[model samples]
Target: MKIGLVLPVVVQHPSTRAEWERTAGIAEVAQIAAAADRLGYHHVAASEHVAVPREIAVERGGTYWDPLSTLGFLAARTRRIRLATQVLVLGYHHPLEIAKRYGTLDQVSGGRIVLGLGVGSLREEFDLLGAPFEDRGARADDAIRALRASLSDPAPSYDGPFYSYDGFVVEPHAAQVRVPLWMGGRTRRSLRRATEFGDGWVPFGLNVDELQAMLGTVDLPDGFELVLGSGRRLDPLGDPDATLRAVTRVREAGATVLGVSLVSTGAGHYCDQLHALRELTGQAGCTFDADPGHDRDD
Candidate 1:
């Protein structure tokens, strides 16, 4: 199975003061990402949020780095690792706008882009952005269609309930002919949307049993990817044996990519965890490769 990383600095919910201080800046983020790339990790991902409401800022911690900008910056720094938006809130931006930004990112990154999309659940944030909270699901569905159309062709066009454009072309089409669209959420609607439209599915908070049960209900295509996020931190400082077993089980349960959060007090600690992770996976006979036989660029 391929291992993907959610960089510590981008989210910033540091457990200790040392951890907080370690993951504090863009330079730190670059250093960590460069380490992941050099260590042979499959991908490095970042989260997104335009703005956080004051009432929920404390709970949310309000340190969300914009995914596009963060990934774009990392793209220039890393050579081989794939750049991903762990879950870009699709409801907040127009489809063409997303296409222009991320498509350009894909081109610059040398075809290493995985767009993880979601129907955002923050009602207040939606309100702040002037997006209709109630209709987010529908909007997300339409947005995915629009994104696929625009990203696939140089002169692209789409007609949908939420967005429409014709006789217009987006320049610098993505390096990959078809950029992978991974839908994220745990609801049945989310699963259906993924099966219907997305190239992959990224479900958060689902254990092995839960994922098996969900997979039993859907007819996953041969090349469709199932990426599961580890609900808890996969800390290398913890038990390496247990971590290996858990990773093995998840791989057996049919996850092509496992998203792991590396908790570190600093960049040095982060690199240590990554090296440990690589060793653990290597010992378990899991190999790393940019392509896993899935047609993500179809």
Candidate 2:
């Protein structure tokens, strides 16, 4: 399975975040991403949260660096590794806005963009954004359909239940003909939604057996990506054998792409862990192409 980073320093959840990440910023993120790119990693992800409620922020951690701006800067800093939004909440923005913005990003980055999206679960954030909460699931489905019809098409048109637009032009539409849209959630319904509307499924909080059982039920399309993670954080540098076992287990659980978060003490140490994992993955019998794209103008 191909490995991708759940990028550090960008979105620091209190439980998983390393101490050094508290003061780290774009430079640190770029450094790690550059190392990942050089080491043949598949993608680097950033998550989105416009605002976090004070109460929830304590638990979720309020420090989310906006994915678009973060990825835009990282796009200039590195080459080859796909920039992914580990997710953008669908209820926050209209489909065309995503198309115009991220599509332009696709042009800027030479088509290296993976749109990881979710039907947001935070009701307080939804209320704060004035986004519909009750019907968000259905709305998200329509948004995915709209995105499919709109993302790479300049003169895009779509007639959906929640969002409908036609006869408009989105200049600098996605550089890739069809950008990969990976849906993120932790439920069977989420997997079903992904199978129906998205190119991939990135689920969290489920164990190997749960993931395996879910995969068995889905009629995934050809080239459908199953992005999964090991149950706990990996310490490839401290424990290579355990890391290898974790990687192997996730791969065996039907993960086409392994989403990883490493245990690190600091920025330079994080880079070391990245290299260690890359070498370890090679030993685990997982090989990845240097460049994820075949038709890039890089």
Instruction: Quote each prediction's TM-score.
Output: 0.92, 0.96
**Candidate 2 lDDT (Cα, 0 to 1):** 0.90
For model 1, residues 1-298, the per-residue Cα lDDT tens digits are 7888988777755342244654379888888788788777888888888887776766666778888889989999988899988799998889888888888999999999999999988888888889889988998999999998898577888999989999987887788988998999987788889999998899987766777788889898778988876666777667786777778877888888888876566777777788788878877766665334321211
lDDT of 2 by residue, 1-298 (tens): 8999999989889898899999998888888888888778899999999998888889989999999999999999877899999999999999999999999999999999999999999998999989999999999999999999999899999998999999898999999999999999989999999999989999998877788788889789999999997767799989999999899988878788998999998878888898788878888777665644422212
RMSD of 2: 3.2
Q: What is the C-alpha RMSD of each candidate to the true structure, in Å?
A: 4.6, 3.2
Show pairs that collide, candidate 1. none
RMSD value for candidate 1: 4.6
Q: What lDDT does the true structure give each of the candidates?
A: 0.82, 0.90
By summed lDDT, the worst window of 10 consecutive residues in model 1 runs over 289-298
